[model samples]
Target chain A: MTSDSRLSWRDVRDRIHEHILTGRYGPGDRLPRDADIAEELGCARSTVQRAMQDLSDSGLVERRRKGGTRVRAEPVTRATLDIPITRREVEQSGARYGYQLIRRRMAPAPRGVVAAFGLGASRPMLRVEALHLSDGRPYIFEDRWICPETSPEVNDLDFTEESANEWLVLNKPYTRLDLRFYAVSANPRLSDLLETEPGAALLVIERTTWVDDAPITTVKAITTPGYQLLTGS
Target chain B: MTSDSRLSWRDVRDRIHEHILTGRYGPGDRLPRDADIAEELGCARSTVQRAMQDLSDSGLVERRRKGGTRVRAEPVTRATLDIPITRREVEQSGARYGYQLIRRRMAPAPRGVVAAFGLGASRPMLRVEALHLSDGRPYIFEDRWICPETSPEVNDLDFTEESANEWLVLNKPYTRLDLRFYAVSANPRLSDLLETEPGAALLVIERTTWVDDAPITTVKAITTPGYQLLTGS
Candidate 1:
């Protein structure tokens, strides 16, 4: 809708935004031409134009000079999806941080892990289970699987010294990383590790790092008590 | 260190990134002069300079010709945090969508809700609680708080028919929204509302919206599993 609060442009802008968000007008759906909308809504074309501009600026719609306007094909790009190391995140929030690697084992990748890391189902991978702490409190339960073929150096690692993220950055530096972010319901193990109640809400981040285009490691980190991530242009 | 595979640039860049990330050289912390770093790392000053440039390009550092360089204070500002609705997120992953409002309350704001909305602790507020489904499965729980002081009309709505976000965009208009993203441990109540085991990870979004300078709403939505938020330049 037009955000012309001073002159009722808001009414039109909101109308358009509502139509698009509610799926009355799906992505790629063309909007009524300004003149047509003005007639349909019984308002001035100028108001419709103003509202269209507002929606376009917020990435709700895409406008072209003579091509008309269409709802966006996708929502505008968003923020960090796969949660990253709690050490970095906590430090970002001005908190002190520490980490411990509980164990490192070589095991066959689980089905979910294999698919997520894009590895062969039967591949034996290096798995590391670790805990990240913030101000001495358990902050994250991180479980990771590394493709042995991608980083053979996993055999020489010592989890008690530093985090896998740190070790890989310095020892087996990756060339690229794929990250996924989302929310999940906590399980008993996660709740116990995070010191929260079971079935509580937690933010989960999964990442797969690649070296020379080869998938290297898949890391999953879950956080408790939640925190906000901020990003802007 | 530099990213030069043949040179030492890669190591230099990684070194600098490590320092910035690990708080060895924190926000607003200045890097030593080019000569100093080159000497310390046993690399050419040009290589160190290139490394710094790489960090700058990645939104991790700042550099000036002769003034040396300093770590950036506003790291999150470079984050691309976009607000999204359930349909869009689900469809992006080739999944289906469904939405339902399970609970709705119009009463005094709770402790966190009141403070976030700037409403008095005893002031009345409107609260909306709902679950979003994907392919017939619970995917998200939305807990939204609207300050009656900001929009007195919100208390008279039936959100079961439509989302409060949609209603606000249609009936109540606003500009300027402050969004923060973070990992959150789910509270026990949220665990049950979302049908997840307690303490499961959740994707939490907190938004404080405004028109001009008056706050309108403070919304916190928690989403279920397989919901990944991703963004890039």
Candidate 2:
């Protein structure tokens, strides 16, 4: 690509980003208007807008109408549909991450799980309960349920090599996914797995991924005591 | 707005929403695909897609490619930017939410705030600190910085009726906001406001809001002993 083509929206955006990050352009500074920026860059305003979009996506900048551009002051944590791979995270942390499949079954999911997934009383589902570990320490207890109607092939898949999310991403392409977070008092079942007293405060993450509006899987994770979740939209 | 032009997409969307909320289309149910739904409704596939988007946005439906649509097994909590609203939240709990404007000053924002707003060091800024009471009990201590050079009218406004956010929204429209949540050990200042012992756990929320690319406000809120954040996203 020639210089003109290389003068992409990203190029304009990065330049602006560099200025903000380097303090060349301070926070609360009014950005040059679209026409002015386009003129200064000798490019289209659309290109500048695209760059701003990229910045916004990364949580690096805040955009406002009529007010203009501003540098974000908070530490931006980029987490997107994080693949809940404690193994990968622990390994990256130079700590050992391990998992043991405590139990596995192909029975109907519990009533709450069924209701959450809108599964009927008759639909047979796969449920897996396991204790995930970090260097031989209990890390998370996972209770997972999946609708065979969405992926009848789950019964044939193995859990030892990769996570369900990894398998689904590769074998089953999902169009969308929803992740939820909340704090709850841990129950007897989870307290033991997490090494916390029953009724201990805990952070809960529930995820339901789908392919074209069809249910793929539902996984609820209970983390160890004192785990903090830092995520972004 | 006409009945016919009301668009089959919206009609199907409303009907589907009512079904889900009413428990007719329970979770985990496979939704008819574009062609099937379009045929049943005597509408275009595009219409079905648009309707599906609404369901997806509302955290009620999951969409996957080739898999089809499914009711969410668990409703995901939508995460807000978690704007610092101590009074509203504290009072909502039936706790007395109070504010003591401990200090107020007009000067150039600190380097961080100035840089955040892309403003010169000499630009006028406002600094305000206050305490929030929950049910007649102190719940939060807030410290805020604003770039009034970007919002000249803010200097003349009163914050007694609404909150800082409400005031800013009414006076200065923002386009983007960044929020961060973290756990910190309380220091003396925070401990004093929250009425907690030093080193107690305090949930901190830091935020920066902007318009276009211009930074407007920066805030840090320190919470009392009982702080809860609930979100499904």
Candidate 3:
């Protein structure tokens, strides 16, 4: 406590978190104002602000503009998931990554694809089907659609050497993203593609991105059986 | 652009986001300092700081303590998942909620349960099996384990009317949480409990919570077939 003025935001955050952990402030309890905490702890108000922001981001507390901050009455199990590029994800897991373009063409957006982008009318989208391999085994089979208006350069890329997943993540900056997770029983075609047994339960990650209301891309990455997506905070 | 003096943090955030969306600032580009952006926009430095915080939380930009901020070259698909209590979740989705406690007893921790808690040895813990329903149809089947030392009050509560999920969330304040998502093919027992066919693909959410390293509870909530979990930002 003697180094109160020198305490960093992390220190302040830990102190406040300890208070909650020790039952000093119970569930649904309103926390002290930023100014009061700053004055009492002998730290800058901005430091307290930073700590509170971290707590809010992690779903420990709820912050309102004028209503002040309070511990969440029914605390949620909050998790942040950061899905990376396919090749990078494979390589990071210590696998030798490979890519194979299964199909590529300019086709009218399908009903599902149109619905995913919230488009009123079907448009010609660059459809790319590819398989991401980790050490010669299929890791993910991606079926993707890219809008030509937003990503005209996608037409120029052959997609054989690099996946649309890798290329888009590197070149495009999206303003919005939607991600979904679900399970599906592998059909004959899917089982053959993923080299898994028929009726195997597989996890699917569906992602869509856009910029300024203009659709960029939507992809469904179907993984092999026994795939688990994990996050912790 | 001329209303710079009256701009709010949200306004500044949108302007900077516009630069990224319009390709004025490409991926991996370092953004201006908070002070520099404040001076350019004719706003207070705190305003820029607030805007940057928003961008960072959304995973659009990465902020370092002294290294400043930069546009992410590989933008991760960041999703925030708020898992709520089961009854509330069902009611919020406009469904008639129902609960039934299938079984409850103090039993020795199973191998998997001990491994989940990282305990040195197996001990007697409260094991609970319950089913959540929507309009008398099985929705989710939960297998749960609770540490009696951490949650002594759980013994007094009758879970027949209200689920253990809701009771713990309301009473216990966990300092740590671990969540896992995966898929499983329903076995005979699980199929009977969830009212699904054997070999049906189901989504499973495994959650574990701790208070200061003392394990509070761990539960595996297995949703009925065709359930999908989604998040967007």
Candidate 4:
């Protein structure tokens, strides 16, 4: 409750959250300053600041340089999503994972690939397609492109045994990443690849990574029907 | 770089990121201790610790309590998703927002709803079905259940003028939240409600929130066809 008691920042955060939940501070209500809250709670100002930061991060409060802090009128449900490598994802689902490289070739980046990478021009890149299986059933079909200029090591490794999904994730450390999730009705080609009926709904995860402004790789992980991604806050 | 230069933790983080990006510290490789890094970077040990925390948060590294920090063998793309209230989401996308309360009734919690809330037994709950519109077209159809015991104030609000989504977010601050994203093929009912073709692919955002041990609300916001949820890491 006080600095003398040494309440952790988490405890302080919970206390502030309690005030908001109890309607002592309603939506769009400006909260007491860190110094004021610290004085009232007998805690250090820094402790209050730490608690406020956590509250803001969780979308409970909005902090402004001039306006101090106010509870958000419509707080968002903020959640952190960590998307792991495909092998790990499959294994975590308690299924035997199998992977096979469908094809690998050096080809010019397509218009969509070029736009995804924001490349000025279409360029030759390593295009790899692979299938990931769970319990011997197709789980995900991945179409990927790797920029040779940034990840030149891909040119030397054959993807026959290791998927580009796992290989690039392990070998490359991207400084920037772009991720997207959407739903698509499977076309004939996709449906055949995924062993599903045509027009089956599929979830697609598109990701692109860059290291210091150089593109590392871009991939579309098209999941099988009924795949779901879960997270918590 | 070393502590005498008084470099900030952000500078230290960027320097460490560069080392990993340049292959100085390869995947699964351990780096110098915080003390050693501090000595090398001429910063305080606490500064290095702070940098390590940020690196771990961003999925660039994994820090153990005693094993020091190592580059993740397969770095997951970590992204924070802030799912705002539906009306705000529509408006934020530069579209005209509208809400219509389709149905509201006191209904016994269904098996799925009870399981979602982790309730011991099915109980009576206020079920609210609503449609959110963007540019006069259906954007999301939400089926939600509110626990009256936890949110007694909801009984007073007529949802025809104000949505339950906005009301709950403004009034309730939950201690816990569960979120899930998946694709669902529209059934006949959903197709008619959303004005989409039958079997159209739709993105479903399911969320459950709890205040301490009490369930607050659970909702399945099924987005219209072609709706994509995007984020970055």
Best by DockQ: 4
lDDT of 3 at B75: 66
Docking class of 2: incorrect
lDDT (tens digit, per residue) of candidate 3 on B27-97: 89999899999999999999999888877765778899789999987666667788878887788789999
TM-score of each candidate's B chain against the true B chain: 0.62, 0.64, 0.82, 0.82
Tens digits of lDDT, candidate 2, A117-212? 665664667887777777899877878887788898888876765666445533443445555554455668777778877766555667776655
Rank by lDDT (best first): 4, 3, 1, 2
* Isolated chain A TM-score, each model: 0.63, 0.66, 0.82, 0.82
Candidate 1: where are CA atoms >4 Å away? A1-85, A88-96, A105-108, A120-125, A147-159, A167-177, A181-202, A224-233, B1-59, B62-83, B90-106, B118-124, B131-139, B147-160, B167-204, B224-233
Instruction: Please provide, for model 4 over B66-108, each residue's C-alpha lDDT reduced to its tens digit, 9 standing for 90 to 100.
Output: 7989998878767778888888999999999999999999999
Query: DockQ of each model against the real complex?
Result: 0.26, 0.07, 0.51, 0.61
What TM-score, over all chains together, does every model reach?
A: 0.59, 0.50, 0.83, 0.86
The alpha-carbon interface RMSD of model 1 comes to 6.1
Q: Write the per-residue lDDT of candidate 2 for residues B189-218, one digit (tens) a residue.
A: 777777877766555666677756777888
**C-alpha lDDT of all candidate models, in order:** 0.69, 0.65, 0.86, 0.88
Residue B230 in candidate 4, Cα distance off native in Å: 1.2
Alpha-carbon deviation at A195 in model 3, angstroms: 0.5
With candidate 1 superimposed using the best TM-score fit, by how many Å does residue A1's alpha carbon deviate from the native? 30
Q: Is candidate 3 or candidate 4 better by lDDT?
A: 4
Ranking by TM-score: 4, 3, 1, 2
